[model samples]
Target: MLINKAHQALTDDVVKENFLKYGNPDGPSDVKHGIALPKFLIDGPSSPFLVVIYILMIAVILPIFVNSWWDGVKSYTKLGLHVDTTTYFLEYLLNYNPAELITIEKIIGFLSHAKEFKLYKRSLTPEIVQKLLLSHINRTQLSPSEEQLKLQVVAIAPKLIIGFLDLAATFRNNEVCFQLVETHRCLIQALNPEANATVNKYKEILQLPGASLEKLDTTQPIYTLGKLLKKPTIDPSKFLNIENTKEVLDVAAQIPLIEPLDCKFTVPGESYVPPASTSHVDLRFIVKSPAQKSKPDVSKLSKEVIETQLKDPETLDYLRNPLKVVEDQPKMPLYSVPPYFPDVDYVRQHSGWVAFLILQKDGGKLADVPNYITRVDLSNLKLSPAEFLESKAIVSAYKFPLSTPTPNVGTYHFRFVLRHLLYFGSDLDIPFVMNIENKPVETKRDLYEIEDPDEDSIAGAFAQMRGESVKKFEHEYESSDDEDADDDEEEEESDWSDIDTDTEDESDEKK
Candidate 1:
């Protein structure tokens, strides 16, 4: 009876506030002035123990119920569900129309995408929410009844979809999702014929492979870096000539300029004196090209010839054959040992000497240049020009007869000419001198006076000797003292200067 009165009092208070029931204020009330209260409020067993048990059950359950109701209210507020829970179910179960049902279906569909709402637990991505809302508006217009009824839904769908997507993006607080929202808004704004097409395109983009999906960011422009670079065209004219000017320049850089070769006396220094007891003297000479800085085509640079020359033509006839029988010498005495007389023809075929001379003059021309000549009488010296062209060096031996029992103590010289075809008749002269004496020749101290031999100076000296010469090239072995005196003086002066400088330094230190 107490519970009944309490329940009645609560219902009267609710009625006086005119709270709508079942969606209408004048609807039949659950509580009436004389009506017995329902069992839930007043129909408990009247026994003391049972009544206490019921009170205990209510005590425990009421607070739990209140807590759960409060939580549901909070959840509904957060999800933006403005309808009362009871009315939401009542309309759907009994009096709901197709349009209303479709809205409900869309909300359900929005929640169905758990992945988009995983963080918010009830949120939807703008893309998904926009898709959910536009599906109903852009449906097939085939059914007139459906189309007429939902024209409003279609008219408002765009605005509402945009608003819903914005709310979803704000709720999620994700920059990528916000970008997606903007993209979906643009797609929806541009949607024509059917909204589903844009939705499908958005889905296709999202469902693409990882590499393609990266292009979905609207913040970046759609362009490939590789596309900006065009392929460069290669012109054929640049390489048309196999032997171009560049090749000519490269070849010109490699051909060495013609220069003079250095020559030296191998057998005699400044002088050589034949002993009175000896009937024959031997001579040797060497001619060498300069150390090549660049190798050139020798075939183009050189031409060769061979001839033998002697200053004393009466010494012997080189053109005479030794084996020729003479009627006047038929009774000549037989020798115990056979003499080795050189076959002039054989030596001429093999020797590379350019000139052969028995010096008789103080000065003469070698390759058409002025040079001091050796003063010795010589014979049977052979020469060849091929030696200088091929080996760039000439080393030869010759036996020359001393006409007198005792040799004349005098200067002698020999000359050799190297004609360069490449240089247009420029010729190099190799001149050397020797001295003949009755006594042993002393070591010439003047030879060591030049501290460093200057090969360039030697070449330059020969450069001044250049002349146009068509003479058949010649080789020679000779001896001379005509140049020795001047050379000795120059060398002595050079040595004296070196000695004087050292001596002056020492004197200064002592002082």
Candidate 2:
């Protein structure tokens, strides 16, 4: 038997291949091998034991793994927030009364419920954070630790809102998203602890670098950035120190203000929208840099420049195309970034505006999801003060497609909200009307131009064939019968007169 096995191993093709590749004859041993099984476990009597092992894996172990994965999925929201965190926000916002004013303290206290605060790994808990925020809101003094916690939570609030904005946008929840954006701006304003009460009340003026409550709360009520810029003979030196005035002016010059040129809701390439027709909102506006303390005047632009830039076919095509491509402008300077936030990366400023269409009749409810305007050209900010004011305007257009048709023929009142992401007072609200017209009535002419059918004509013959009659023929038949009756009466009278004359002649002859 040993001699036969040796011959078979030497002659086998598999053994030869293994010897050539791995230099082994017993068909190459695995590099890593499991322990050998016991004789009883590998025997026929172990079949039942093997079946039990498989049942345990399938029924218990597999289900345990599946349940763990499912639990993980249920724990987080689509916004990557903990389920409890989302529930906390929703419940708080639901009970919130709209009539009540939204103050910085109220919003900060509300934001303390976020679960991310626990991740700080400090002694701070959600309840402790809430109590500290409440004390801050009530104007109570806090210890150093409590103060640090308050600032940290306030800093985290805006970052948390940025995440919630993404979640709201993912679901296309416009109203909630807009409210979140406004809340973000409020939180940013709250970061400045040195701002006075007046500054807190009118937070919009804070967008300017050197503006403060003392300079802004003067006789003239300049609460907004636009108002501050538009103030006649705006002297930065009056508000800012002489050394800092130039820096403030340069920063102010870069702030953008949108001036609406035309806003209309209509069907493209058509004069009017018929009932149940598809339509879209067309918004035309110019992005003007308020460098000269006033709105950019389009009239300042020469006639030739307007005709070439605004009225040219290529420029018109660029404006009308849904995908607008314009020359890029210099990015926002680093010095312009807000300094109160803990980390610039978390609260990086974006140069864009979110456009929202709201229906006035529905209590100013959102009519469509928001759109972003990020392609605006800010090259004018780089120009000298004089050239910047008189330069050609940076015209941008946005088209919002309505999902549903206007089934009714009437006027609709809508408000366009142009909300700036970084600035508070730079937002614009424009109210416009959309008119849906009725379809035109068609005037149909006779196909054959047949005259009023005569009773004796082929047209009349066809009418009779179709079991129809003309009113004119009926009136003519009645008139002919009346004439015949009158003629017969006259003839009868003449015959009677002749008979009377003949009888008289006979009587005379007899006499």
Q: Per-prediction TM-score, please?
A: 0.16, 0.59
Clashes of each: 29, 0
| Highest TM-score against the true fold, candidate | 2
Q: Where does model 2 exceed 4 Å of error?
A: 1-74, 92-104, 120-123, 127-152, 162-179, 191-197, 200-202, 210-235, 241-243, 266-271, 274-279, 293-321, 324-335, 388-391, 401-403, 438-511
RMSD of each: 52.9, 22.8
lDDT of 2 by residue, 1-511 (tens): 6666467657988766776787656666768853255656657777678768867988999999999999889977776777777777676555655567654454455567677777664666767876765554333568887777677776666666766655555444455667667766655543233235565545655556556554553544655555555562356466443457677666665677777766887664456777787777767666665644454566776777556444324455543652333323333333365534444654445446777877888456677666656656555456555665665445555667777777698888988888876666668899999888886777577798555576767888888778776435555345577677876887787888888888988998888
Off by more than 4 A, model 1: 1-45, 49-53, 76-135, 139-511
Best prediction by lDDT = 2
Candidate 1 residue 4 C-alpha distance from true site, Å: 48
What Cα-based lDDT does every candidate model obtain? 0.33, 0.63
Collision pairs in model 2: none
Candidate 1 residues 1-511, lDDT tens each?
Answer: 6566455545876643443444333445575453234555445565556566677768977889999898767645343432243234333334424244233334334433333233333344545444533444233233565344333333333333233433433332222222223333222222222233333333312211121222344233222211111111221112112324343222222211223222333222223345343333333332222212222233333334112211112223422421111111122111111011112232222112112222325433111211111221111011122433443432222334333444366666654433221111113344556555555546575855534322346544454456322233232545368666876989999999999999999999999
